[model samples]
Target chain A: MAELTTLREAIAGLVHDGDTVALEGFTHLIPTAAGHEIVRQGRRDLTLVRMTPDLVYDQLLGMGVARKLVFSWGGNPGVGSLHRFRDAVERGWPAPLEIEEHSHAGMANRYVAGASNLPFAVLRGYVGTDLASVTPTIRPITCPFTGEELMAVPALRPDVTVVHAQQADRAGNVALWGITGIQKEAVLAARRAIVTVEEVVDAFAPRPFQVVLPGIAIDAVAVVPRGAHPSYAHGYYDRDNAFYTAWDPISRDRDAYRAWMQRHVLDVDDFAGHLASLAAVA
Target chain B: MTAWDTDEVMTIVAARELRDGAVCFVGIGLPSEAANLARATHAPRCVLVYESGTIGAKPEVLPLSIGDGVLADHADAVVSVPEIFNYWLQAGRIDVGFLGAAQIDRHANINTTVVGSYAEPKVRLPGAGGAPEIAASAGEVVVVLRHTTRALVDRLDFVTSVGHGTGAGARDALGYPGRGPVAVITDLGVLRPDPATRELTLVAVHPGATADQARAATGWPLRVADDLAVTSSPTGEELAVLRDLRARTAASRGGPTRPVRPTGR
Candidate 1:
């Protein structure tokens, strides 16, 4: 059975320095509160992984917690570039960051391979593209039956995988809905998994199109309400479009980004405190 | 019929390029607008697929990102991300791959990754999501970008997506199943690949745009078709539907807050 614990305890016990951590979400249900707790713990040298490294990953990159990034795409979504990411890569401001990039297809199949306990996955991608030249992990393979060529990428098994979901029952079964990206595969592909949920209920009402992770599969479940703020939690709240728009300016400058993180992430004790501080300022 | 912005004219041109019942792999920004416009106006049966695993998504509002919930809300099916690429895209099920690029070269190669060297210096644009596969696997790829010398360059600083490679047969050598980029639509006009050279050539100019102006805007020594023609102006109904769509998109939650235009010029 999964242990029910606080966010800080969950991070402290499960995640460690130099672990390859994957926080999976499509464009919603981002485990931002978990990211904040990781920052608050001051964990360092992590290999951060995601399909699209949005604002949460940007915060991790800015805080000098990440040493490497294995991702397909990194951006501010509706906004422009991630300035902290740029600074790390372009100028090595916080630290010299290493990047191993792939296409969305490539990364997703890698996770699928890991979930299946396969050595690698095959797909017809990266052909005639520059990515193959840059990322050595992508290689060519031939079909034994037809002699056709395909691209192959190794499986991605992270040390820890964290995600945010809508509900978790008292039995520790987690339920997620709406735009479920690779959360399931990501969880199964990791050594340890943590799920932060909007609420802990007594029993789950099964619904169509909902993915339920069995209690045995998860290591820990933490109740962090509004955990996916900035990013939405599907039916619970609307995406903070105003904050996304506001981030472009705040994250554009180095000093501004550092100051904002200091106040919002580092100085705050927990997610609730972070929310309270935000409310007080607003 | 009515005064249309350059962006509107570009959208109409892009929409006309789509065939009815074509399965188009779409990206965000202008490609989404063009594909949605094609569905609303000319190509009503066009199937819109997003990389977020939403297939046949007919959103009432423009999706802010590929992963916006509105896409999944009305999608015919929402599969996992791997299945969308391997089974649908790489299997050659997509008839058209519509994309937007930050930088494009004479060979139609696109760069959405970086502006300078790989390790350092200059701007860091959004890296490729599904474009590399979309360009290589789709039966045909179409690009929409702003018309500027900087955008239409002689050589891209980095090639994020493969088009015709350097010339004809270049992409084939790499075992790409698709034919690569066939057309490029810009604010000024349309560019098609030359049959023999595979170099992008000016085929048609939008109204109020001149051949000389188009040539001057290209970074390379551009070649114009001997019988270049003027694009037919947007019809009144077309403009009305396109405008209405934009208005609705701006009003929709999780949609563009401002007027939709091409980014990454």
Candidate 2:
């Protein structure tokens, strides 16, 4: 239960370049601030996954920090386009980039099934139509015992999973309090897990069930209060819908996006300056 | 049935269930054609929601995948992936989840990941995307696959998504309740859950299907509904409309995928 001297030191130790990482926050979930820091550090060849909501995926794509993306549906309405991924796919832009499309619950189930190590778990889903060809990860194979056909879903395991939590203790057990999309699975499936907390509580042992992610699965924890700025926490700051509408227009045009990023994200060494710059734009 | 056979009956079946104003989450291939047929005939207002984020898609033909251009070519509105899931799907506004299957067990669980063992897979199909979410959140899910032994499995290689969640009782235990499956419309017939077990039970027999044939094709002990009904053979009226729709669709750039079901039976 040792507290790190600095946030950058904690993050640098947990991450290595070209690693496959899964971020905890959605497009609107500012839990991404930690990951944005990683990107700013010049990580490359990252295969990022969007479990469900993926407004931020475009940002990753636009910045080129994200080379390979695994997701069902990842896009923004007004500004960003599926054109990048599509173009990459046409030319295999990010080599070995795989697109697996399915419903939200379906994506979660596959991950859960992988985490549980269950050979197969049955659910009455996709009964009447053709959502079967989203990805080639799972295929129908004849059951040797019964000779019946079964849909074989693949297992997903990321190299590292970085999640932002509401609170945590020095021990690294953090609280996510629902609205956690595949966070548990990310922790369960990844080789290493990092939990970033808004605040570190000293009296964490007072409550038990409040702990969402256990310390056993966590390798490191970073405490950054109100770190989920720009991206809001659930019911905290409302989603920066302004960001959503603005991201595409800025990123869609390469020159404009690069200029905006240089002005907003890059060239600022400190978080305070970054925050102030973002505020100026808003 | 071969393309000649499936062409007649498949079109007839697709036209009936789909109607105007229905919001259908379309699968890529055959379903794209079926829904398009419905749109051409009587369901002009049926909105097609592709998993790639295009909603209210009226593709000219079937799409190869969700990323197919036609899905977005004739769209009403397009939103972000997160919004589509957080707002529309997980929020449960979609009426139908049109899907295909590689393997379907007794409970209708699907596998879209691998064909062999995970440690070293023999075949890696596409991984599960949002299929589980669709099954869990759609008003109801519709499975469209060719009736055969390979697809109608006793067990799946990998359970892609839980359609009913370990049969009937488990759904309630799981807490997040969904409408689950309404029907699994296949080239052979239609399937529904058993009254007592909620396991997939043969509810309708197609014109060419027999109890013995269905049993022979199943990987499990095929159970027929107590009041199983025979699907009507394609009549001239139905065939004409179906053929016309298929011609227009196939001729159009956006028709469905190859109307071919591999004979794994």
The residue-by-residue lDDT of candidate 2 on B90-181, one tens digit each, is 67778877776677888877776557664344554444556666766778777777778988898787776666657767655544346767
Please state how well chain A of candidate 2 matches the true chain A, as a TM-score: 0.80
lDDT tens readout by residue for model 2, A1-282: 334334566567766778877775533334555655775687777887656334445445556676667665444322223433433444443343545555454455556665677654333334332445445554555667976544555566778877777777666677753234456776777777777677777754442113267787778787766566545454334334455455655654657766776786677764556677888876
Return the top candidate by TM-score: 1
The best candidate by lDDT is: 1
Candidate 1 regions exceeding 4 Å error are A206-208, B253-265
Please count the clashing residue pairs in each candidate, in the order shown: 0, 60
Q: What is the C-alpha RMSD of each candidate to the true structure, in Å?
A: 1.9, 14.1
Q: Candidate 1, clashing residue pairs?
A: none
Predictions in order: chain A TM-score: 0.98, 0.80
- TM-scores for the candidates: 0.96, 0.52
